[model samples]
Target: MALRMADTPTPVRHHRRSRRSRRAVLATLASVVTALVAALLAWPGAEPADAAPSTFAHPGVTVSRGQLDFTREKVNAGAQPWKGAHDQMMGSKYASLSRTPKPRAVVECGSYSDPNYGCTDEREDAIAAYTTALAWYITRDDRYAKKSIELMDAWSGTIKDHTNSNAPLQTGWAGSSWPRAAEIIKHTYTGTWGNSGRFATMLRNVYLPEIINGSNSNGNWELSMMEAAIGISVFIEDKGSYDKAMAKFRTRTAAYVYLASDGELPKTVPSQNLDTRAKIVKYWQGQGTFTTGLTQETCRDFTHTGYGLSAISHVAETSRIQGEDLYKTDVGERLRQGLGFQARYELGEAPPGSLCGGSVHRGLGPVTEVGYNALHSRLGHAMSNTQKLTEKNRPAGSNNLFVAWETLTHADNPS
Candidate 1:
């Protein structure tokens, strides 16, 4: 994956008006009649006789095929241990974990802390493929495209054998896996790259139905529902599917949200919490680190259903996309509050020994510290009110370089 570019101050475009000219205009427009005349004068070219389709277009930048190919190679090689275990499990061809009796989902929680544990579930495999494919799409690299196709094929086949329908298992492993897969599929379709339609068909026809039907009654029902929503959203790509999935996600997410007593997430953050936060922070770390350092499993929490900052962020973003001003909603306000707590805790700005007070983990301090700064800057760019946040979290030195680069590349890009 391409890393985020270094920041180079983008030249500011300024329009200057003389103070005297402004005063003269104000004086001239003091009267009601004058003001009306001024409004008419300033009005953009009188409404067109017949409004025409907008001709506005965005500039297209060329993608780097070499970079994409290199990144795909690294992901494939690096994910080998996880892939090997997945393959071994699939080779057994057990109908379900209940039948074959694989390791419990909780066993893999340690994987979040240990790099060697490897990820379980078909979703991670699909995500690895999806990211590779995205890189290929952007770069137009045949190597990446080929590898992506291969990975997808393998994942699809493995998943098909595990579930009788499309629904996933309730195991903690599947909790992480399904969402990652769904996100990958969603991005692939939106990006207009690869066999997104065919991929969706496979998921809907084979993977999802089984997982959903099987796990529907379990406590993991919400997890399955959440992933299903994401997958259905990608597959249907219509208002109906979008509405249905959105409704379902909202309904199921209530449980987790309710777990937040008085709208505050518990402070005894689990290992999963750290892992999820680490990846969420890494997302803004820039493209290079994102492509090389973060994996699909690592980033799953950002898009999944759970009681974490990542989940809250996803809900906020999803609501915004749906044209709902989440900032005005109770959940949105709660998320803001939670993020405020995180910021205070991470920065050592909170009261000593307070619930929201804790030292940043040594392993994650560097990346998250930089991430906090970048995230605040991006947020500040969108809302002037967040300027203080940007300043408060601003990273120093080399870390600042990534934030600058991201600003140049994505300054005008909206979430």
Candidate 2:
């Protein structure tokens, strides 16, 4: 029973009109935004960020708890390669009980380790920590665990920063291993690590800042840095660093390894600003011809190339443990081709004069196991050249940087 006006009020009609106009404007704005997003996505050299996991997995940097369990089970059974690999590691100086931690206040290095101050000690200590961590798991000896903790604690307490030209790369190399040892001891060891929090702080303050920024010196540098970043992120449970590092890893992985599908000139990291053909060629170590599996440093040397490849595998393995399974993505494809290409030449296949001017370096080192195990054993990919090279270097030992005892941890490991 409301009184009806002869005509609608002027303000009410105006309000209705304004609402309709606002909705129309909103609709138009949404359409424009959608079109812009589509354009951005389709732009050339657009590197989209990969998705991050809702929750991270523990003891999952390059190696997992399941992998540890499986490897230990095999070792106990006196398995052929596993037993041999374990024996080799147990016999090494790294697994020795008398090992001492050589932490540095400020590690410094120049090009090609010219300065080499605290470089060797830092790398060796990190490797020793990881080696002992593995030994502790397989042998069930409390001494190994305590020694690992001791090594980590020494570095964590003393390492304040890394300095000089190779600081970032050096930090990256050592950073990659610290988390591996930290992850195992933090999660698996029955005894307590009193200074575990301090170790995490050292990684965050000293190591993470140096490597997480993604270097442009060389693909290997950034690759190794990202390896450290990813592993450290998992150990400290920092999701943001993990995502940032993962994005860089994906970008660097693509740019580091060349594929025929990536077009005439290899994919370039945008920040590197590799605009012209000449500049790109120089950055690629003067290799003009492009082919599948050729790395940015393939012409520079196989040793550096192996570092990039190893970092790729380590990041991919860690990502897999976190539940993303990057191996099923383009990461796996690039790794497969990269490994095979290097392996083919590494296995004594002569490169034509066109390839690296016919003089390719040998010695790929203990870098193939992690990648091989994931692609071949886990994914059932047929990689003959990689397979041969990997088998020839069974029980792959440390590269004296970050890669250590992968043959013991990952040989035919199905977990």
Number of the top candidate by TM-score? 2
TM-scores, all models, native as reference = 0.42, 0.92
Q: List ranges where model 2 is wrong by over 4 Å.
A: 1-50
Location of the lowest summed lDDT over 10 successive residues in candidate 1? 396-405
Q: Candidate 1: misplaced stretches above 4 Å?
A: 1-123, 161-198, 206-228, 238-244, 251-307, 322-328, 348-412
- Candidate 2 lDDT tens digits, 167-261: 99999999999999999999999999999999999999999999999899989999999999989989888888988898788878889998898
Clashes of each: 24, 0
The C-alpha local distance difference test score for the whole of candidate 2 amounts to 0.89
- How high is the CA lDDT of each candidate model? 0.33, 0.89
137: Cα error in model 1, Å? 3.6
lDDT of 1 by residue, 28-115 (tens): 5566566566664333211111111122111100112232233334345645322332233223322122221122112222322232
